[model samples]
Target: MKTDLYLDMDHLLLLLLLSSGLQAEGSLNQTDFVRLVDGNSLCSGRLEVKSDQSNQSWSSVCEDDFDQQDAEVVCRELGCGAPSVLQGALYGEGEAPMWTKEFQCGGNESALLDCRSSGSDRNTCSPGRAVGLTCSEPVRLVGGDSRCAGTLELKHEGEWRPVGESVDEWTLEEADFACRELDCGSAVSVRRQESSDRSVWSISYDCVQSGSLRECAASDNSSHWLNLTCSDFVRLVDGNSLCSGRLEVKSDQSNQRWSSVCEDDFDQQDAEVVCRELGCGAPSVLQGALYGEGEAPMWTKEFQCGGDESALLDCRSSGSDRNTCSPGRAVGLTCSEPESFRLMGGDSRCAGTLELKHEGEWRPVFDDYPFWILEEADIACRELYCGSAVSMRREESSHRSVWSISYDCVQYGSLRGCAASSYSSTILLSIICSGLLLQPKISASSSMDGVSEAKQQGLLVFRGSDFTVSCSIQPQYPGGSFELRFTSSTSAHTYTQPAVNHSAHFLFPAAEPAHQGSYSCVYHVHVFSHDFSSESRQLSLIVVDPRSDQIINNPSKIIITVVVLILLVSTASYFYFKQKDVTVPPTVGSVDLQHVQSW
Candidate 1:
């Protein structure tokens, strides 16, 4: 019977392969039985077993049976490099029908099913108990200050080590291919260097000018390591200067295309990182698709930076699956050099007494200077990238006979363009300017709109629940108006409020399917007849349906639930019948032989 079952299983597996268009030409490989799920790349995601019963069905593989040897076969069969890391349920849980068989791979098996197995079958498995893996990239850079410039490392036998003999033989074209593979621009410098203290691997490469480094001819040899430096890949386009324009990042894939970044997701912190990476000063202004809209394939990840990261890729960002941004929202940035003049003796850079620079000497202006006006102060603040002038005042104290220079800026040009006053004074001038440092906070509630007593909190809501979104601005200005906008996958809606209130509210009668998405607010005010707007960070609202107890309606769940119930009933029936035949017979004295026989 066991021999017959084995033959039946092999026949079934062959039929599955033929029906799925997979040729049954040779021994079964790992790709024929193993697959990845829920990841952006083939090298990532939860591991699952392709059921021999059908191509459409799969069972989650257990991490308990996973090891480096198993991962090696999986990666090799998938046409990827060796496995860099293996994780247990790190990518998230899988649906039922987990594979319970334990594999004992010898690290040389071509297929997972060909390896020795314990043949254990389990009725149930713990949730989130699946295997995950991150395969090593074929080419990488190492031992450098930045990811772009580093010692070239190649993957051999699931490990990344410095190239050995091929170091002297490597050409500029080969180095360029390596740099492009890592998406770090073209190779600027390639030189032979002494190997590090770490172990070195013997590898030879015959790379061509075209194609990726992975496509190069490779062999084993022993020699020195190669160090390389790649030029900065990021660039600004369609602006007056290189440091001011639309932001586009080069793709690390084989196509080597460039993609624009979405301004709606790019924030000031992200802008700072980009400027610093490009050798530019801090960002003066970040515009949203200002130059012009881009084409398709815009980056949608929201970059989160701590204002100190060396590379934009080093900062934490949203997952690549979030492709919510369109070409119309491409990001633009204007970076500026640090200001020559600075404020002193005040709480902050924007609200301090003013100082001037002249002839390489620091001096102060007259407090009672006749030409002092808001326009001049505005230019000074603009030079510092501190928004506009909020207030200007005189700081009175005992006289210090330092040199003073006055400027008359009549609502035009930079502070340096203003003409200096002929006279000098000992008194100092003090001014306070509105800074771009403030960011508004957004909150949501289930209560009625415009209710001051209700506290704003988390955004979790049920379907058909009435909700209100409010945005509160700091350092309120009388002429500033608030605009609230809501965006979903298909459409967007906006609401506006006049300048009378510092806080704005948008009331929804009930949470509809269309109303679920991201929301943000902007504060705009007219300064010198020109409008300036400050935008807030985006907030996401998730609406759950109480009737279904799910965030959204999924049609597949119904079928899965029915299938699970049927399997449970079949297993229970089989166990019950098997136990009935093995039950002990009742004693003759009990006088229940007829009843026992009937049961």
Candidate 2:
């Protein structure tokens, strides 16, 4: 019987492996393709390769043969900046089909295929020899609320170093070059660093307006750091309209400095402020660094807005904490106008698949785009004046006409500002919205009887006990249904039931650790063929282990009761003795009755 059980388990494991459909050894299909896997960013990952007729598969490369030049080629080919770290198997080991070929790159090759390679078979390489890399961004801004304005850091020798302090007088010409190098509009102001921080002044550079910073002469003198501020300018990039596109800002007018705002610090209120600042109406949609990643300098400051602020700078900011902005979190915005996008074919006007109107034709948005997130859903719901997004789903496109454009919304803003491009896909997104008026109230009880005891008992249950959670709608609407949802830190479970007289109950037969979580219910009803939903207040349930209850309630309760009785008796004895000692000192009128009783 033991042998049979082992064989059954082996069979199940084999079935799982087969069902996964992982490629076989050396079965890659792309002949001239390269990609990174299992790493956090585009620059860092385990390297993989493929040739024509073979699918892209994990392959091994010798660490000795892989150099910084070869890694730079790979980074450039992948549209990344430069190589930071190149190590074999640093990301993880690869499978079969090791590329034992000897590669030689000159560090300037546009594609990895352009580099010279000595053909060799996979047999020469050993296991765990796959190459991994970390790439450095070409440019970045530091220490500012806007991306276009900040202390500039440039990548040199695979390390990020601040530009050298000016030996000659620092001029606006050099500052203009730096701003132009970052693709920002133009230079606004140039200022010298007041403090002599040697760490930041490791290298000093003398630059001219026509040449790149790399061509500038370097010195070892540790003096002041050069800080450049670009002009106070704002523009929308990568969109068709002047009011829409990726949002870029320049904070300082004296030192014209600009930087991309991070999505982490942006929201709908911020979008509204940006629109008003740009002389536009309210924003229709807002997205986070979806159009494209900005250079290193990001606006790390957090903005606090009430959605009525006229300017972004007028809102409160998190001062001096610029580290909150991370790479690839730039903000995007799309302002409300006559020619924007809308939702169609949902349970209500507020809920449905996204559609953009262009050239007098409505086009469907493809759901397969990777950038769709909760922030995008929130922006969409808000655009429709809906309360909030309850759920987002992908479904097959009902119509044959697909929108030629794709959007990326990382955080809040107008959807029009999201980077748009031509794309094709068969699936489309469907969004569901819940208005504010439909919020439901949920209660947990020990039993389903009309008189629930759990409410008085704080909704606490012992392990192995049974409990019930009920949701009721006040001034209940007819033809509504209830959907119960349970959510814990790690997992979520959902159940649905038809509402009986405006109430629905969920039962848990045996409470356990898995059942300990906050539960909520939604009351969904169809009115005028539109779906309306109300969510209940969250009900938290706590389940105590039986052993813990025993330890806390049994011997501990007995000890407490015994101690209380002893204290009571001692107090009574003390009072009696005190009365006995005061016999002769009583007042004459008051003591006569006591003396007659004694006689």
Candidate number achieving the greatest lDDT relative to the actual structure? 1
**lDDT, candidate 2, 516-559, per-residue tens:** 77788888887535567778667766665545432122234344
TM values, all candidates: 0.29, 0.28
Model 1: number of backbone collisions:
2
Clashing residue pair totals per candidate (backbone < 3 A): 2, 44
Please list the residue runs of candidate 1 whose C-alpha ends up more than 4 Å from where it truly belongs after superposition: 1-8, 11-74, 82-136, 142-150, 156-161, 164-191, 196-209, 220-224, 228-260, 264-272, 275-309, 312-326, 332-599
| Local distance difference test scores for all models | 0.62, 0.60
Residue-level lDDT of model 1, residues 276-379, one tens digit each, is 77545689888787777656367656778888998677888777556577546788888774343678776457667776553245666553345577777787
Q: What is the lDDT of residue 128 in candidate 2?
A: 60
